[model samples]
Target: MGADRVGGVRRPVRAVAYAASGVLLLAGCASMPDSGDLRDVESTPRQDSQLRVFAMPPREDAPPAEIVQGFLEALTSDDPQYATARQYLTGTASGHWRPEQSTTVLAGGPDIQVDRTTGHDSGDDYAFTLTGTKVARVDAQQSYTPMVGGYSQPVHLTRDKKSGQWRIDVLPQGVVMGQSDFQRNYTSVNKYYFASDTWANSVTSATAVADPVFVRRRVDAMTQVVRSLLSGPTRWLESAVSSSFPAGTALRRGVASLAPDDQNRLTVPLNGKASGVGREKCREMATQLLFTLQNLTPTVDTVTLQRTDGGTLCSLKEDQTETVATRGSVKQPDYLYFVDDKRRLVRIADGGTAAVAEPVPGALGEGVQKLSAAAVSWDEHTAAGVGYDGKSLFVGSLVAGGALDAPVLVSQGKAEGDRLTAPSWDARGDLWVADRDPARPRLVLLEQGEGEPLDVRVPGLKGRVDAVRVAADGVRIALVVKAENGSKSLLIGRIERDEKAGDRPVVSVLELRSAAPELEDVTAMSWAGDSRLVVAGREEGGVQTMRYVQVDGSTPEGPPPAALTGVQSIAATEDEQLPLVAYSSEDGIVQLPSGAQWQKVTKDGLAPVYPG
Candidate 1:
């Protein structure tokens, strides 16, 4: 026999022996004594990585406050089905309550106080108020949105007429827990969907956009991700991206468990809605599954789709996925481009050992037209540069004899600092730039980097646009906006295009949300991965630092990159394996390679950037 402590109670582990077989079976068991002096057991906190927590059921004749506390603690336990949590509710409430409806994350533990206004001191009825500061919310769709303000919900308990016991009769629809517990239980995962506007002759050529959502980390994560993918893109991205799965598609009835086989092959069983699709469409569906699962479970290298009748609809291998849909802006960049001391656009191959910088092949590189900043297209065949005056924008080819086109776009701001910002290119080959003219601030987009620039309507903009960077998928864009108080912040917005408007579609940026709400000043930022960005900013009354923030406004798990001083601009690629490039007033152009310290690339270079 051995003893172990759980929930601050000592329980014995016994070995039972079968006389006939002469075999010993070790088992750990714990039970509450039916008739004993009751004592409170402190709920174990999930602060340690290796600790497993087991929840206790409702005690006999527990007080209303104790009952509420027990239920709340049980909500944070690792129980897969939350069976122990349901034990604290009444029979009717247990049947009607839906814990999976949603989750409310508070800044800390909720405060439980008896509601005096109810005045139900009759011993048969009681009411309590659960209050806390709102932090965030995870909806049924697994979407996590950061929120602010107060949270006050009422919980009612009634005495059982026969059992003479107290049970919760009225409560909120979903569970509520502290922010620490929420972080411990849930994780973010990206679901892949093809860009609706990028459909070409070859399905593999379409671009894949990442829609991030949160799910329970220890629960049926694989199944949850698959269901989320089948449900289609979230509401914010529905207009911009398309899923290969057909409408009303779902998992086959009675199929609950999903896992990969020994050979790293995942077989997904779908309903009849997917049975009618042809081989090409089915392969596209499989491609989405392959990429979506690979993010969560890297071991899954192949995906095979099955119809309702258990017949194979289609199968796609990992190597074939790229042909179906390209991951966001993952093409390797040939050179790191920046502006040099002479105002000419120059490049260094892979931040080379010799640190030699050479001028690019274009009019802007010839030093005839000095440039303040520049952006290279993903294909590396074209480049856009903002003039030294910050009022004119020029586009030229990378070919040796390529000529510089006249200023395609110009700003009217009186001051140079208020004029056009450096341009950015999307994977679709379109160019985006923000005109910071205070009198006429607007976002401009060019179709294939030419023709008349379209004014992108931003419905809820409350500040002046200072800088802009568009993600490769073309469905999202990042901006640095200056407020009236002379502070700058980072924001992420969704790009929606109305193709039915006319020959040229109407473009709009919707739902601009803070990407770095904690930072009071955001100097520079760039896309570092599918849903992550490397941000350079500082909090109020704090020193400058660089960190990674998700589009949903949540910080990543690991520690931020090593601090860099005076980062005027920064650059990163969707491929995280590549080194990070940045321009600092203190150190000039520097690159941080994997497992190494920052090394100077050139003292004359500025505005370092990789291809979008």
Candidate 2:
């Protein structure tokens, strides 16, 4: 969410001022207008009242495309010249650099090549898709200065009628880089999953990808329904994450259902006429995430359910069973998932590492908060995770905020190199998890008031446990283990608890198996239904994801018989419908309603979420 002032994006006081601080996004997919027919298009009508505040027609003098090009040239100009660009500027106080910010705008012949241009943002904004091709002029040799990894994709630009002139409002390329880098930097931002393609060099970064190109596609698609909210046809600047999905992909419509198993696991699905490629892509990404991410290596493991006595967590405990894990790769809690009755997340935040993203204004405001406490901190690594018990709600996130009112415990485990990798919750009040810090040794179990004696020494679980989840009805348990080379894997099976292990239970693990594909830094887990589960995991080098669904639809099989791809973190409604999976990578939550259609639920941006 942007802020309290955020609404379907209203108009501006000045043409240029309208976009002040209004992010200019580009996914390297430059969709600009062709030079021929720039002025003929008409502005789209506004849907929401506020979005049309500064709504006005473009000056009769200049074409929409021409106005946008003016700003584009000013940005790349070698010599200082704000003349054309200033004409189209909104002229508001903002962070957007002005002509004065430039020493000289490049003039004469430059490296900009217009590719494709079209009526964008509900026809209210004209756009151009151009490439900053490093073309060698007759007198000069040209070499491409790689953007990010390399090969700058086309840039998408948007033009709007701010007042007398058509002002450039959105920059798809700039927005693309800005948002992607922001996400990459946070390293903590997590989402359900999305489906996709691999036409070229790009791995497509797993699923469909939220790059600029993908975002614009979503924006345009959104216009089909809410045509009025955009007086200027609201531009899809950067982040694909939005509060709502295009009406076509919304979850509230019908067909799909949600179910929660005894262990508090959730299940839901998207049904209808979804393309095989799309579903397949989503599954592929999910599979990668579930099968990878956690650097799990186990020595001794087991799954067992214990009845509770009284407190928030069950009185049961695990005696030393598996060898202590080496290290669990849980960087953020959101990466990990657990089946819950309501699917309550402590706080849903948007952030990334400072190394990549721009400074998040009071980043604290964007994260998950339980009991009304805001947990946001860039000084340390953060994780977003959920805890469900069919009844109670206990969601946890790695924020600098401490509930007990103590100094925020920065990642103590990580700083000392005793990296606390994966972290997750279980069906009951208990959480199947493991975080680490040197001075502290052994695989320990924890909750707010749980007694110390109940904490068990999971044998073979030497260093740490990356990610862990208890299966349906608490019949099975899954854990990501780290091994000698630091390689991680999933260890799933049955566990038996011992009362003699001192009020707590001694542990026994049976039928342990590793995921088909090895995982690196395991994240989260949710129940799919009919006995299957969807786990969210991330590999060291690959994209984040959720995969692995149950087959028999009755038992928690633990590790899956095969690896699933293009999916991450399952939040199904149980056995009824397929599942309502959160596809963060694709910038929304997807579902299979009834084998007939697909629904995408998102919260990328809306008004600011005023904290409690």
Candidate 3:
């Protein structure tokens, strides 16, 4: 047996997992007797305090896990030089292990956590061993970031008998982490992933799918990501999963099946205890996959949709693919239309499909499949994610500009299989899109009568345009572009003043650099105001937040995505301070000010039409 097996036997040893089922509650298994006696106690101690501090030849009373965590936090602490490896060690980690080569190293955030800590002794020598869990976000995965498992080795230090203080005892030549992590630490984002499952259950209560087996598969897939080992392999697997199961593998497999919403033992507990137990053994490690963004060409096609009411939503005669033909009937997994409650199609995309699922054991009803056949058209080329209209309904691509039969222009040119995320419009009737057909993915003004874009050019931009935001007055356009070497730049230009760069509006902010330890969030830019640029993202929530950074270098902290979740259908409010008004894809519209509270507009009995 290995030391891991022996160590697990004497103390609380968690199951070595790389994954489980629906409502999969993650639990640790211990080799220690009466492992059931353990509870999440307040006295469990902050793992950091257990560090074995280093002194003189280097040694102190502490656990290596805590020490290593501390070192990781400190090394990445921000010095401009610390942007790369050699710079960090020269300024931080260089005191010990010095690397002879100059290199550029990439690091993801908050993946490793010391789950259970203990001390190991070998005769005259002693060390602190930390058995923890870690997950990594690498480019290798099927999705954005696939969760996996990891292990940290024992760190060294001598017991300090004289002074009660635990000082730095020893470091392994050099540590693997930096200083910033220590300065800012919070695992709240990690906590929220599981919580999202609960929220998903609640929100989707009315609309239920009856498949259980397929649900189990998805749940297991998530377990694989969550319990995956932290490494490059896991990253590759995430991309694969995200590509293969764009509908969210975890959401599909975990909830409806293992812990079906049905009134059985699974739903009875609600807390997921039953669900977690049943799926523990079903943990699935990530399956490796390799893909890249290849399909950037827009293939246009026109198809008529059959709304649930059996009414002709529209002739559907539109799309750049052809002159606009109409399909008499709609089919499954073709197009997904995000419609308002009143059935106004706001956003629509093709190519992506829903996950396959199986009915739960004894959960199938005598009534049979009650769900209506989705009438929207989708295929396997584009994934147009809809934007939620916080006030009235969700903006779907199918109904933008009140034209169900509007010409569908498929801006095709994205990595094959990569979910080139597109925006769902708000109640404002605008679809934010990036297309290469115009030779610029930069912001283009899309309107009912506008034959072509008015040539909205951002001031002094130098590369492929990733995103564009328009102001309330339609004057400002904010864009983000990735410079070589993973550096992000924020560019804000006057759009209304000069939609076409012919007349350059006062270039407010040319370039605002990021101080983030990880540049993942600011890689693409979105417009928050006519002049103020919002640097943020979705998916990786905890690491990024909504903040106001202007072209003039003045900034203030802003609301989190969760907080702004209430403010949908965001449109520039025009007021410098009151920057945006969010239209609800559901009920009412929300007005957003720079520091103002969100306002609603539902007095006028405006009904929403959900996009099919």
lDDT of 3 by residue, 45-104 (tens): 122321211111112333333333333333332222223323212223345543212111
Candidates 1 and 3 compared by TM-score, better number: 1
**Residue range 1-612, candidate 1, lDDT tens digits:** 221111222222223344356565432332222331112222223444433445677877866666666677778766777898898789999999998889998888666666677756788877777778888888888777778899888888888999888788899988898887787677889999988888852334888899998888767789999999999888877888899899999999999889999999999999999889998898889989988898899999999999998999999999998777788774777888999999999888864444688899978789989999999999999999999999999999998988998999999999999999989998878899999998999999998899999999989998988888899887899999999998999999999888789999899999998888779999999998899999998887887889999898877677787889899999888888889888899999888887888888888879888886
**Worst ten-residue run, lDDT, model 3?**
288-297
Q: Against the hidden true structure, what lDDT does model 3 obtain?
A: 0.27
lDDT of 2 by residue, 1-612 (tens): 110111121111112111345543322121233332322111122122112112122234455554544444333221223343445555441135333211210112222333333435464554444332221110001001111222233333343445444555544322111222111111110111222111221232222211111111111222211112111111221121111122232222342333334643222222221112243333332232221111011111221211122111111111211111101111222221221112323232321101111212222223322221111111123322321111112223334443322212223343523533223332223333444445553333443213341344454554355545544323345666666566556655444445465755664444454432434655545444323455566755875655563321111223332233444444432333333344444444444444433344343321111110
Give candidate 3 misplaced runs (Cα > 4 Å). Answer: 1-558, 561-568, 572-578, 585-587, 601-612
True-structure RMSD, every candidate:
6.2, 24.7, 24.4
If ranked by lDDT, best first, what sequence of candidates would result?
Answer: 1, 2, 3
Number of the candidate with higher lDDT, 1 or 3? 1
Poorest 10 consecutive residues of model 2 by lDDT? 136-145
> Candidate 2 lDDT (Cα, whole model)?
0.30
TM-score of each: 0.91, 0.30, 0.28
Off by over 4 Å in 2: 1-411, 415-428, 438-443, 447-449, 461-463, 507-511, 515-525, 535-568, 576-578, 586-598, 605-612
Question: Which has the greatest lDDT?
Answer: 1
